[model samples]
Target chain A: MEQDPRDLEKAQAYWRENIRYVAILLAVWFLVSFGAGILFVDVLNGVRIGGFKLGFWFAQQGSMLVFVVLIFIYVWLMNRLDRKYQYDE
Target chain B: MDPWSVQTWTYILVAITFTLYIGIAVWSKARSTRDFYVAGGGVSPWANGMATAADWMSAASFISMAGIISFAGYDGAVYLMGWTGGYVLLALLLAPYLRKFGKFTVPDFIGDRYYSKQARLVAVACALLVSFTYVAGQMRGVGIVFSRFLEVDITSGVLIGMAIVLFYAVLGGMKGITYTQVAQYCVLICAFMIPAIFISIQMTGNPIPQWGFGSTLSDGSGMYLLDKLDGLSQELGFSAYTEGSKSRVDVLAITLALMVGTAGLPHVIIRFFTVKRVRDARKSAGLALLLIAVLYTTAPAVAVFARTNMIETVSNRPYDSMPEWFGKWEATGLIDFTDRNGDGVIQYVQDPERNELRIDRDIMVLANPEIARLPNWLVALVAAGGLAAALSTAAGLLLVISASVSHDLIKKTLRPGISEKGELRAARLSAVVAVAVAGYFGIHPPGFVAAVVALAFGLAAASFFPAIILGIFHKRMNREGAVAGMVAGVATMIFYILKFKFGVFDGGQAAAAGLTGDWWFGISPEGFGAVAMLVNFAVALVVMRFTAPPPAAVQDLVEDIRIPGGAREAGPAPH
Candidate 1:
């Protein structure tokens, strides 16, 4: 049996969309963890959230929450893509 | 008998559970070569996620990470950030595509994609390098956790853990490891959270471990646990509990390096392959993140609770009045209290920086429940949790090593004519050999286990992440490009690490002396993984532009990998 070229192209397209989302998430990941947590910490220290400093939250807790959301979003989005492309399996 | 009963029973119970899991894995072992390496390709998404969690959560996360957080204060979130943040990259960027490609091993994906055996070989080398370093650390962690609880020598502890891990991994192969890891994840999480709940209840009257972190201590001072921790840190000349002093740039770089490194790690990606479908891979990653968050979220709270309790108890106490935990941990060489002022009392102060004692950071997390005079069973539970974390991760890493040697090196390169049974035999043999080597390294670790573990992450970030990312996304990447990128990234990282670790070239006692020579872009060797990854991308792209595209057949193979229908057409045999 021969292989289908279009199937491969579709896969590549899926790959591109996935990568785009990941890259964006990576940027946010960088911003929240390093940006808010460390770089802008002094500025963020002025801003408080529920008795906890905002910057400290990013360093200790906020970044982790973002990561969890990112993964869940990725899974949900990819599942939709998988179905759209008839690659549900 | 009572002291040993809970501790001994926990070990025995965990051992029996692991044995049964391994037995089940063997019974459901993969049938074909693909099955042997990646399961029969029918794992449910949730189960796969559990397996990945088991694989990803190591001794560090299970045991030492909380300890580090307890000691390092807010700065310790680096582990939480780097480890969890990397999964975003994995789920969004890596897992789905790798699943779509549907390869048995990472090297398999690279090899077929690049149309170059050379590319595959380079990947195999990187996988071996990353896996071995990581496995060595896990083995060492297993030994440490066992030694502390079982009252056995570190060497014996390592050997015992190795024997059990080898049984399931070799017998069941990837399928076996996958299932066993799920069990491991359960054991580890339960063990970790149980102790945490008890300690939190004692400290804050809150049963929810995660929320208990922000609660006020029982002293009626109205100060939150973290606030008290910040105060103690200042008194000890340490940075505030919620603040770090390292340059924002360096911390950013290190965190980025860890995230990318986590995504690129071979052992982690391999877990995705165990599931049957591409969608399952995506779901698995999400599930893994959720399971890990259980511990990552609770860890900081544990650290804060432990730190505040330790300070409040020890402050102004005469040296002779120090608690039993001090002596117990000090015997382990993890806790050291030095009275610089000779004041006849343990003076924990944040000012007059020279007046402080340096306690090992790893001691804070695990020893917290014990330090607070929690029950003996809770301490035993912590020991079990630590063992689960170390052993599961170690088993996963050892599988990578064993697979690379038996499947990639021996079968792919050396002798393809070996029968399936013979190959399985070789794979099992390799597993045993890998365990022995890793156990040796763990017992005689090079430096601090946690620091050395960070270097492994750096190495993975530099070498494997780039190659895998490029192989899937860039169709034009050739053998030369992949090889050049991997070599450049890994070599640069190694040179940087050696300079600092062994004092190679110049022993720079002065920070500035080794700054330029050792560091690239002012990022420490521990944080250079990000830099290495960038260098890999640039090198691969440049090299590919100069080189030709992969052959038509390889391109077609990529297309085939993407399409689900052709799997049955190509079938198991390569005609």
Candidate 2:
């Protein structure tokens, strides 16, 4: 009933890789929602895009789009990572 | 029929749909203990995704969120950042491991991981606190929505919501709630989006609400909708729509607190466990986010559009010519107009106290779909959408309350010999009790729904998030450390909140600072979750390092949780 040591190692490696992708995605998340919306508000406000001041857009609309994109990208990367690690059950 | 007649029909339709959902749940009632708790582990990823969407999207999302965004303007980004950012942390750090642990409840995982019954009990207490606070808000929201549309008393409306939730949740358990939530998600999104589309088209000649937000308005103004909003806000002496008034450190801390607090919420975490596989958990999280984003993206647009339109059209309007919505909502006492100067015109502004309007912010968004003059049916759909958001989240939070009581308290502690069937009944009973308690709170309502919700998040962040995270990633966390951390977190947060909220410590309580100065590290009580979470981590780490390590059995359990396909090897251990 024991799991093969190699498979366990492979699973651990897959998890680590998955966590890495998540970390990268999270960095983008912080950038969009927090960095662009709040911290970079002054810098973003100086620039205008379409009808929205950039900072306002980031706060209201832009951060949301980034969040949606983050989720989809996560699914894609996790699926790929799962396949590579042979852990797609 | 007149529009009121149409609105009445819409109410009937929503009622019928809700009833059928519960009927379906009852017909498909869980047959086994596993079926009761985890839906027999057979739910499809997409379906589970829909259910998770229902669970995550609460009354706040449906009613208050858009309003918050509308009135708070740029500061509204806090809710957006906090709620959405939590999903990223959840997907990466929590969901996969929780699924691998293969438990029916959060306390189950905590108990098994720490090899201590006390850890489970502590988790139960936190879960109950968070869920009850959350469910009470939802029940109050449900009452408000129903009483507004159905012409019933708030108490009666709450009773109706309770009946609907209890019937399905008790019959089908998680399985029933899952399918019902899917339908509720569909109802809510359709209800929300249809009006948004109408309003966008009316205001900007744009049908797509999301993109129309940045498009030109009917004024032939070259400025985007957001640009127009900023100009108006400044004109009224309000802060700009996009710029924050809070210190940068405060914003960052609050945003982080909401994200981590959201990630640690037990009801939300339990949703992933219903899916069939680890991959499904990840996939479902994505789908839930997509469903949630549909509303999140449209909400700000609604806020900006509504704010501008209201200021331009209603401000300074003759009292007699006030729109029908004004008259109708006035009757409900939700919207009030007073001519302080006897000028017979309603002046809406933020400055000079004498000129400031006292309109409830909730009105700013709820009245949007109606203000834009969308179809009567679409208006009715908004009513239905609001109910779905409140009821679905209320149901999920109630279930967590039930699970903590039955699994963690009764079965684990008091009566270990109880049969599986007996435990199921206990869970149902627990749910009923939780509903009654929440309903009482709803009728009396301690504070505004938004404020109470913030307090709940603080409790969850301080008490639960660290323990769960440490239990999973760090093997050194012991029962004493976890319990002490939770106690410290909840105690500190409650004491601070009470000092301001109730003025319990009144005379020269300078340290508490009533409301203004009580914010630890500049984070408002609403945003204090981040501070509590950090405190929890520090306490747990400090306590555990000086304490003995958990027994070898606990270490193996931690090791076992990480490896997929090894659950069978661990076998069932007797208590």
Candidate 3:
């Protein structure tokens, strides 16, 4: 168990921040996949970028690219958080 | 076949690649249990990323997904999105935490977290069932590829595949499988991308398939590729290519099920364990998805290109004018054309009775190079790529089976006193048995292999996903809640699968016809996994409220895993 109050607080702060990042990122995940890809697809199909409709693009390709980007962003943010909290070895 | 024929080229490419794989396997044979199970837990993020991508992309993704997409059109997004999106969940929601826990298998984490052997047993059974269902399909895939391309009978193909998998999986274990998978990833990706690029350049002026997917055709028509497809589909009495035919709710449910199921799979989860640190786990998951996206994003373009090319080539063309591929594939029974109107020309329309052409969806990918009239070597590359995909995945699934039996079942539960050397021996023996059984299924596949494969995803989504999530994130979750939840989840999924998919109790094969229209909430049996997973989450939370709180030790372990930094320095949590 952590004896120092500051250490405990820092850990708690780090975890809270991590969860917040997850929530925000997952919302984007939900938006791209479930939102644009499915629910709003018909509506978004009205808009086109060359051969790809906005929704069709999201469904087949856009959402996947975003997913890859989202993970790397999470990694970068979490690594920075660890440094900020002095959790880095 | 002549010496310079496509068949000759396919044989040479297949032989050279197989020898390369066997050589790699021999050089990297495993010596210890850690080496066997997790590649000594020292694989680089890049290599692990490639291996995971290769392992996760089975024969379905490589050989069949594009074909399915070609037939399904807009409805195919469910698979494209479902498979790729799950990696986000894996990286963010699971991987780092699991790595911090730092065990060999998923069962070890679940059993320890819930603090019950019974929970572990539930997990092990689920893993074995899912992995076995999956490996059989892969072996069958290998047989199909060989039969179609190399002119080898399916049984020989399956046996040869079995021998190769057994050699590496039993000898080098995870160490051999991981490195070999990395090489397979290279072969498969190159095989997949080269054809896509060639075809893309042929269709559109753009060389980038992803961009070419959205570009206007090179036929000097300003109409975009997708627009042309949609127009052609409507002209032929099929629905517009960009518009889905399935109900929206069914699409949502299927997508969600596939996404959750991908994350829950034991073989996928174990790949993270091979990497050393928590961050490596997260980074590698990203890399895996990116690599997968290379093939996935290209598929839609290929689908559009092939669908259009096929329609233009033979839609109303005369029987005598039909190309060589027409008769070749027809002999394979994937394509059949009859002169329904007693006219010499073929009628490949949407009206079933008037339609003179019958084409199996799998032919799209198999006949793609021929459709494009590409060179012999590109066709051969596709065969080699298909084999790499099927074998890599089969080897991965076999390892999961062997590990579940030897490490989780025998060492942890049945005989905790077994020596390390003894356990390693058991793992190898289990792998050998697994390869043989998988080969059997490949040769004499059950009639319901496809349905059972769907059930494998459903089972993973229902049972393992909820159990593992609650274990990692919920402090109050106890043995009773987990055990009850897993059992309830799996039972619900099985009941749905049997009732709708197999129709075991209803009317068997006869009821299978009515089953599609009779789905609950209009969600098909394949999509029922999401509903079942929700049921699992509900049952677990409700059960946890009544059960005694977990011990303090379990909570500490959760805390330790939550922080992604220096898991080693934290030391193991007391059980």
Please tell me what DockQ candidate 3 reaches: 0.80
Off by over 4 Å in 1: A1-30, B1-32, B339-343, B349-356, B448-452, B507-518, B559-575
Top-lDDT candidate index? 3
> Each candidate: what lDDT?
0.75, 0.79, 0.90
lDDT of each residue in B351-462, candidate 3, tens digit only: 9989999988877877898899999899989989999999999999999999999999999989989988899999999999999999999999999987897799899999
The order of the candidates by lDDT, greatest first, is 3, 2, 1
Better of 2 and 3 by TM-score: 3
Backbone clashes under 3 angstroms, per model: 7, 1, 1
Which residue segments of model 3 deviate by more than 4 Å? A1-6, B569-575
Q: In candidate 2, what are the lDDT values of residues B1-575, reduced to their tens digit?
A: 47566468667877778877877797778775567677777678888888888899998888888887778777887888788778877776787678877778888887887777887887888888789889988988888877777778999999988888888888878878888898999998888888888889878888998889888876676656777888888887788877757777877877887888888899899998787777677778877778888888888888878888878767777888877787777877877777788888887787666563566676665677667776666777788888889988988888888888887789888999988879989988888888888899888887555555777888878877888888877877887788778778878777766655555677546533545655566667777778878778888888888888888787666666664442221112323
Poorest 10 consecutive residues of model 2 chain B by lDDT?
B566-575
Interface RMSD of each: 2.5, 2.1, 1.1
Cα error, candidate 1, residue B438 (Å): 1.2
Better of 1 and 3 by lDDT: 3
